[model samples]
Target: MVRPGQIYKISANILKSRLQMTIRASISCNGVEIADVTQPVKEGVPEILNMRV
Candidate 1:
């Protein structure tokens, strides 16, 4: 759950991809978007996505 007057960090890791593609992520709190990120991913590689709100 999300509380008011607090800061949060979100993270995600991508692993074991067979094809290269783009990853898009959106973070929202209480129907309001806080962070939006777009990353390009490669095959057989690991990628980390991080955002702060």
Candidate 2:
């Protein structure tokens, strides 16, 4: 989703495999990392979402 302030909202599906797995989220601009989320996602579950992105 796009907003007026040049802000974008993105969502991703974190797939799970095996008994142990890890997932992360991030945002980048100009080849530089901006946001990073260090969290693991559970299988068959939607990652926690923020509506007011």
Model 2 global lDDT (CA atoms, 0 to 1): 0.51
Give candidates' CA RMSD values in order.
3.4, 4.2
Show model 1 residue runs off by greater than 4 Å.
1-19
Candidates in order have lDDT scores of: 0.66, 0.51
lDDT of 1: 0.66
In candidate 1, which residue pairs get closer than 3 Å at backbone N, Cα or C atoms, i.e. clash?
none
Return model 1's CA RMSD, one decimal. Answer: 3.4
**Ten contiguous residues minimizing lDDT sum, candidate 2:** 1-10
TM-score of each: 0.58, 0.48
Clash totals in order: 0, 0
Model 1 — TM-score against the truth? 0.58
The positional error of residue 15 in candidate 1, measured at the CA in angstroms, is 6.6
Write candidate 2's Cα lDDT for 13-52 as tens digits: 5465555446565656668875556545566655553322
